[model samples]
Target: MTFNHIDFYDIPHVSSALETKTNSRINNCSSSVSKFILLGFSCTRDIQILLISIFSGTYISTLIGNLCIICAVRCDLRLQTPMYILLANFSFLEMCYINATVPNILANLFSEKKTISFSGCFLQFYFFFSMGTTETFFLSVMAFDRYLAICRPLHYATIMTVQRCFRMGACCWVCGFLCFLLPVYLISQLPFCCHNTIDHFLCDPGPLIKLSCSPAPTTEMICALYNSVLIFSTFLFVTSSYTLVIRAVLRVPSAEGRKKAFSTCGSHLAVVSLFYGSIMVVYVSPTAGNPAGMQKIVTLFYSVLTPLVNPLIYSLRNKEMKEVLRKLFRTVR
Candidate 1:
């Protein structure tokens, strides 16, 4: 895949020749890029099945766990508080986020052909971005919920009413979708005259940005700026919210009150820590050599493992949820 540099601004006749040359190169490249090879988990046959089984279990468990949260929150009238509502929303978003990446991965693992079409790849990237960003927003919202519950106990109900919670959830979904539209569009517009083989398991922005044959400095800069703003702003909000929460918890006169507050927030804090920590390590660090494998492992933690754990954490730790589940089982039996 040779890229011929043509100065369209300077040479008119040469520009025509360059256009023909570029067209020829593009046609060949397009034909060759009919299917993108996904260099997934392992090259060994036995290891591939092991990877498939692991991903399948993760996918099924994630779906079931999130669905349980949603069902429990909706069915149990006693659990209809703003906090549980937000928890249900987070579970739903996590389910969508994991679904966006896991099924394709499972399919690639089992099939002999590990190729994804160009448009298919872009669509995968789009959904992954949409749901991942939504998760980030939901996390921030959850943090704010905790902040209000702890810092402003008297006003918690008024501040996080049903209407307000619904509005916040909707905004999280819409804002995340809108934020990535420009970046996805910009990446789609660039001609892939270079290698089409994406190094990672999915069509992530990092790998796609590196494969652009044209001078993509502006595109890269735009992506980096957007990612940095999203990551850093959300981190700041979460940190500040939790800091206030900690202060309020400490000021509580009773040990039981402090313990309850910490228990309510412990799971969310654990998840946020894991997610942001891995993201900073993968994206914020300088991309000198290929870190695709390492990135995939970190990506799995957030994309697969986090979703799987949300319901488990909430269910196991929450007394209200446990009672609700028990009632549901008895009713079914």
Candidate 2:
């Protein structure tokens, strides 16, 4: 779509230019801009090249790592339980989560314009938030799986049948995609002013809402409520599940049994902490009053870094997974 072009360098907060120039641009362009300039990282040519190289490597590694986890779970008959199935599904979701944004970010790095079409931006907005919401559901499901296996060992196998596992996984994917439809639609319908530059990397709701010519307290509240309900409800489910698991573990008389249970749960807790710790800071508040630089850093933590590290957290910490991966590598060779 055709959009009015304003040199990003002319933007007041972006550069050292005065706010008058920004006001002038906004005044001059009365119509809604159909595209937006994503001010990802303004830097020298050398630094841009360096960033491209760094993020390229990170993306490739993340894809390979998550793919390996999925493959390990699939190929190994020994790893074909409910927990492993959920783990594989989670890995696939992580791959999707990172893919929703990283490829576009990489392309923007290469292009001088760094512009994303309105449709493209909203698509990213939908998939990114959807997958993130999906992750919370998956994490909670995984925790519940652990809770059953640890706290209610007798019914674990009966309750978490293969059929039921697939059903639960399907529900997570469906619900995740559905949850954000209203909020995204509400935000998209808002009339945007002449300022078409988004301060953050991807199209986030907070920045998009900030760009609206008119105030939308209802939209803002809805977005906040969606985030709060999704994050907190799933977080509570996970924490409660783990709490019961811990109590059950403590009750075990054998030290080795308790150690084994703790070891199994440790990797999931690590992944949860990394994912939730970063996102809560950004999404919990409606305004998301954090500085642009801080927002980008925190987004990177959950979006890029968490996916990159999850494979290692799962494979390295779990003995069975490591063994299965090693054997799979040998079979490939």
Q: Give lDDT per model, in order.
A: 0.85, 0.92
Global Cα RMSD, each model = 5.3, 9.5
- lDDT comparing candidate 2 with the true structure: 0.92
- For all predicted structures, in order, the TM-scores are 0.91, 0.90
lDDT of 2 at 295: 92
lDDT of 1 at 271: 89
Q: Using lDDT, give the best candidate's number.
A: 2
**Candidate 2 C-alpha lDDT tens digits along 1-333:** 899988987776767555667777665664657899999988898998999998999999999999999999989899999999999999999999989888988988899999998888899999999999999999999999999999988998899998999999999999999999999999989887788899878999999999888789999998998899889999999999999999999999999999999999998999899999999989985467999999999999999999999999999999999999999899999
